[model samples]
Target: MTLAHQTLALQTLGLSKSFGGFRANSDISLCVARGARHALIGPNGAGKTTFINLLTGVVPATSGTVRLLDEDVTRVSQQGRVKRGMARTYQINQLFADLTPIETVGLAIAEREGAGARWWSRVGQNSAVVDEAEALLTRMKLGEVMMWRTATLPYGKQRLLEIALAMACKPKLLLLDEPAAGVPEDERHDVLDSVEALPQDVTVLLIEHDMELVFSFADRISVLVQGQLFAEGGVEEISTDPRVKAVYLGEDAHV
Candidate 1:
């Protein structure tokens, strides 16, 4: 049963979350195929964040299991998950305001290289780390501001830097939580394009409300409505789904 045994890069079975008698997620089961570009979309308060938090161990699921590469990780800590090739970017950038982009990305690179504890040594001694840090920043199109302070960069650039930082860990599964959020439309495409260009080995699971971006970037789409999966299909199937359209109402970006 090789086909039946095909391991997913990420999978959730009956994943559920609740708070004070309120159910934020309900028995959700889903999978992201290896190297797939998958998007999860839902209306506000549809438990998108709650679901993400469950995957990242930000919150314990009320009941369910999570698997990475077919290995059970439902109880893994967030850091543990990161150590196992899982990395994510948030809707809001969480950056070290005082560190330069180069320095910030360098730190992630150093950690990945197991040189973090020895970073006090001269930068020249860590040529490999420096090279990799630079490469990741450049790949994310942040090379021009690589030496700039994190706090001083524009919001869009900050988002890009966050992605660069995530990539520095060399994740097998990259979870992007609204990477284009708060970015001007003019700048969003560039950011999304960089994300889309990521290598095939880095399976992506995107959670975004921007349907245009979602459609452009996802090979398949899943619609979550009121804490449950309502529909899932290819871009065309999702775009024309009557249930999804009803959920979006007058929002032109729904499709």
Candidate 2:
């Protein structure tokens, strides 16, 4: 493989998916470089979610290939992909309301270590796991409420915890689906800061409708329109592209 290929954290070739009579994703070939902060944006029905599902192996593609860290993972199961260093957070967090952030993250860490079966018995007893969970939660800006029940924390903190849970797997590629969705305006900054502060070694692919977050966090951007790639470029290029403004971003959109 070429050095260029070696540097890609994720790549999809002609990746497409369909359900019954509907085509949710067309043939899409995209690349995300190692440690790159890439954003995928589109209109409401532009199929961004379906594309994320395909990447995470939550939904199988009708055709095409998915490669994670340069290895073919097109046929890998969702759990298989996680084992191979690919992790994702959903648009709507799937957190355990009754579990504390520490417990949630601790279980994730244990699962990554192949000790999930004994996680309940080992959570507090395993100093290594506990330490790592604490450290991860703190990094995600949930240190102050690490012991609070998830349902009681603010929405933004809950979102941060979801990211923290994904991080526990030590993934090479992290897919964040709308980390700022449903957050109060005042609390949005916490989500932004936590995402920006993520380690450079962990490449991030963000799918968000919030333009402000996309512009702030993404160095590279891809605009998907009607399930096909409409444009791809650096932030300035996309922000200034007149066609993008016409179709997705309103004419009055404040780039």
Candidate 3:
């Protein structure tokens, strides 16, 4: 493989998606470098979610190719993508509300370690799994609430738990869809800190409307508008560009 291919965590060429007569994503190409902090930002109805779904194989593209670690995975199923080291969090966290953070994360780790069928039985019995889960929860700032039921934890903490679960997958590429959405102001910082503290070897593609998190977390930013890639550049350039500002202004979205 060429150096360029080796260095890219994700690459999409003419990636498009359509639902009947409506096009949710147009022909668009995007590249995220290995271990890069990349953010995808756009106004509501900009098809950001659709694009993310396409990347994760949650939804199939109308036409395009998705390359994860330079391997064409356009026909790969969602489960297949995860097995290939791609993991993601939803805008609305899908967590086991009844389970404690430790149990939840431990199960995820066990699953990754191929012990999922015996997850509950191995919880405390497996020292390696439990230890790894504890360390991941601590890193995500959930050590204090590790034993609490997920539903009882604060929204921000629940979000952190979701991230911790994803991290347990040991993903090479992590897709975070609006991690800060619905989080209260006071709790937002913790979420941001947790994101910023993620392991550098894990490439992050954050899809968020919160400009604060976007600017703070992304080294590179891509702007999507009406189902197409409108702009892409370093944080400074995209934040200061008049055209980008205009697009956000029209949608009453903060840049």
lDDT of each: 0.88, 0.92, 0.92
Among all windows of 10 consecutive residues in model 2, the one with the lowest summed lDDT is 246-255
> For residues 134-164, could you state the per-residue lDDT of candidate 2 as single tens digits?
9888788889999999999988899899889
Better of 1 and 3 by lDDT: 3
Clashes in candidate 1: how many?
0
Runs in model 1 lying further than 4 Å from the true structure: 1-5, 119-124, 250-255
The Cα RMSD of model 3 versus the native structure comes to 2.4
lDDT string, candidate 1, 1-255, tens digits:
445436588889999998989999999999898889999999999999999899988999999999987778999998888888889988888899999999998888888877888846875478888888888888888999988889999888999988888899899999999998899877777788888788889999999998888998899999898899989999999999877897888566455
Model 3, 1-255: lDDT tens per residue? Answer: 589999999999999999999999999899999999999999899999899899999888999999999999999998789889999998998999999999998988887888888735745798999999999888889999999989999998998887888998899999999988999999988988888889899999999998988998899999999999999999999999888998988755444
- Relative to the true structure, candidate 3 reaches a TM of 0.94
Candidate 1: the clashing residue pairs are none
Q: How displaced is residue 9 in candidate 3, in Å? A: 0.1
Question: Candidate 3 at 247: error in angstroms?
Answer: 0.6
Point to the candidate with the largest TM-score: 2
